[model samples]
Target: MKAKLGPAKGKVSDLAQQHGDKIQHGLDRAAKAVDEKTKGKYSDRIQSGTGKAKDAMERLAHQEGTGPGPGAGPDAGGGTPNGPRPPVS
Candidate 1:
């Protein structure tokens, strides 16, 4: 059985979709602040992490399920109780 998303997850997914641009702006500002505080010492790493975060947010906002991210979809992962899940083996 597919695991149904809880109310909180549903709300988060809706918020993510609605405020994705604002969220991305916040991420950029945070990354800039961190880079400034480090005086460019960790600029590369900070930028990389920021890019990844933005991509993740975009994906979550676009996910076609009740929640965010990859495993939040009904067909994505095993969340059923006492159900047999396929092992990689």
Candidate 2:
């Protein structure tokens, strides 16, 4: 049982790492698109928010081994009982 579980756990870890990278890449691309569409007018704010979102996502990926649990920072608003709410006003 232990021998069989080792490979399965390794595969799951690899998949999670790949998925996390893909998600972060997608977020970067989306941020770039938004900046381009706005002609760089709101570039600073967009980049800031994008950074935060990426961080949150990475944190979530890291927390996967801990079972289902809250995955957001304290300032991430506790209003939503499901998951992290949007970091916007």
Candidate 3:
């Protein structure tokens, strides 16, 4: 899901969009780990924490400009397109 943000300078929306999914994935894994460690004793707490983590990550990503993008990926001119290109002569 896309997180809304107010107009601000130095925002990194592209990065957020690209990494948000990865961050959420990691959080999910962490939550699962916690649940496993607890032997499913605190399923509710684990789930709640997971949700909070996901929400926080999304908010932070959006605030930092790493949430979803308009197109499939980040927009051009956002940063180094793809990867480092050949050095200009």
Query: What TM-score would each prediction reach against the true structure?
Result: 0.65, 0.54, 0.52
* Superior candidate under TM-score, 1 versus 3: 1
Write one digit per residue (lDDT tens) for candidate 3, span 1-89. 23343333225544556688787677778877878888889878777777666555555554443434556464422332233222111
Global CA lDDT computed for model 3: 0.56
| Regions of model 1 farther than 4 Å from truth | 1-5, 67-89
**Ranked by lDDT, top first:** 1, 2, 3
Better of 1 and 2 by lDDT: 1
Candidate 3 regions with alpha-carbon error over 4 angstroms: 1-14, 64-89
CA lDDT scores, all candidates in order: 0.65, 0.63, 0.56
Residue 26, model 3: lDDT of: 76
Give lDDT tens digits, candidate 1, residues 6-75: 6565567678889998998888888888887888898778877877776667666665455446555566
- Which stretches of candidate 2 lie above 4 Å from their native place? 1-16, 67-89
Give the top-scoring candidate (lDDT).
1
